[model samples]
Target: MKRILLLAILAGGVVTNGMAQSKGNLNSLGKNDPKAKAILDGVSKKFSQLKSVVANFVLKIEGANNSVTDAKKGTVYLKGAKYKVNLDGQEIISDNKTSWTYAKDANEVTINNVDPNSSTLSPAKLFTNFYDKDYLYRLDGEITEKGKVLQNIEMTPTDKSKNVFKVIVSIDKKNQNISKMKVFEKNGNHYTYEITSFTPNTNVSDATFSFDPKKYPGVEVVDLR
Candidate 1:
């Protein structure tokens, strides 16, 4: 669970050579495809115009042999620098200044201070700002699912020291929103996030981004900061 949470925070947060070759030559060429960038720019623009967003997604993890290892559903609420994520047995809430990582099973919550200006990527940033730098991307064409057209883009990180090597982003062409992201790690593990539902320009209250200790009596609070 810690590993998955870390993956969620890292630069948006790879595949084997054979698997790489199977995908295509986009990453091998190491050039940014203008068409892909344009689409990503459109997505960023659309997201920037919204006041807030609530997105529900599914996190699917796969093993080296392409078998499903584990799957969990999660939801994220975003308002400017503030965001909250609800995942299996855990909730990560941040009000742009402080963050709370709560474990439901342990009835514990860890607190830490956070810099809103930091370049770290939240699940919300993963949709827009993730492609802004250090990546070589190309349009991998399109596919139709559920009667919607989704454009596929293959992205490769220029930095070799990163744990994640590649990320395949699928964009909802018509809506100009991200629909799915398949991330491959050097460990041969695969993590895929599929947006189940997206509601933009939500009227969520600021209080939603904070964890109220009063709501849970006898909960342990660990202040790391």
Candidate 2:
């Protein structure tokens, strides 16, 4: 199965007057702005230069009526293709090879192997040339908040059959790091992921990405990999 946890919470988009209603699928990517590509390229370059990342974020889900339905706070640790996320008593760890999903309530950890060529979009893959394909994007100008400038970019998927119809991404003007991402669904639901804090080149060990059942006295291990 696809990585359910990250896919459910994550994901990404803009100043378009109105979001286009997604219906049938499109085989090819649509319009891609050169300006957006340049800015995105810079974002990718900066992220590639980082040794590691420690970020705290919040996910807010809003209903069709624009009411806040649920919210969650989480932290993500990133080092190359390896990363770990702790959210709502659930831990997802991937060592660039194997993946460990631990549920605190169940006291069980499920294991799976990573597919290197798979275009699975985890938070770790969000920055590394992620916008170049299967997406049509454009620069939506900038926004200023608390004396900080954020560049806004709007994105729509080439495949219209997907549940997510659009995405709006905000990047810090100074650091070029991601500030926030808002994802819109076809069913009048949306998710917002705001990067509360970010630290690059943080010290993290390889062992941090690999969850060990032994560490937990009575945790059960389900090796599906």
Candidate 3:
């Protein structure tokens, strides 16, 4: 269960190109340049038009001296404010109001109330809105990746005390989509999330965002709400 949550949080903390500003929050955005704002807003507008998104990702956790401590691959389903993620032998389902994390090995499911504003990765913040409040952003530079031109943007958290100190997002210039994200933590660790496949407007039922424990026989439910 702990491993599942770690993956989810690591994936969710990633920021895509978007200008979804948090309400009454302008301090962190004061350093944003006009060019950077334009680039991010363009990407956000394009993503906002999608009805749903499905993507596969590769997550890598690096320790000191840039040694990769762990690597995992996962799939994510997103529609509106809801999301479902499958990583390792665990699954995370969120209906935008509540979240369920189920571990196959332990046959246990942990449920909790959803908090979108939490520093941790919440689906609500992951899909549609991010990075206008917590971090001050700027266009670091541009580069080429896999024959595609990508704009690199760097962000620093407003609160210096946060565990995550810096975030860098690599955006696909042609489509304005996030291709990769790197998070630098204060504890000398870093996380990287690379989007391997992205499909927009994928047909999916709302029920996919909710979990049904009955389907899994002998699953123990632990409610933390």
What TM-score fits each model?
0.84, 0.85, 0.87
lDDT of 2 by residue, 110-202 (tens): 998887667666654544444344567778999997678998888877677978788888878898877888888899987888889899999
- The local distance difference test score of model 3 is 0.75
**What are the RMSDs of all candidates, in order?**
5.9, 5.5, 3.0
Top model by lDDT, which number?
A: 3
The better-scoring model by TM-score among 1 and 2 is 2
**What lDDT score goes with residue 108 in model 2?**
91
Tell me the tens digit of each residue's lDDT in model 1 across 11-97.
Answer: 322111112223223445554666776776676666667788888888888999999989999888878767888888888888867
| Clashing residue pairs for model 1 | 14-184, 14-185
Q: 1-225 in candidate 3: lDDT tens per residue?
A: 244334443342334433434332345346466676777777777777889989899889899679999998888888888888888888988898999988899999999998866766566775545655666677888998899898887877778887778888888988888888888888898888888988999898999999898899999999999
Cα displacement (angstroms), candidate 2, residue 123, comes to 3.9
lDDT (Cα atoms) of all candidates against the true structure: 0.71, 0.72, 0.75
Best-to-worst ranking by TM-score: 3, 2, 1
Worst 10 residues of 2 by lDDT: 13-22
Residue 68 of candidate 2: its Cα lDDT? 92
> TM-score: which candidate is best?
3
Error of 3 at 162 (Å): 0.4
Better of 2 and 3 by lDDT: 3
Return the TM-score for candidate 1, rounded to 2 decimals: 0.84
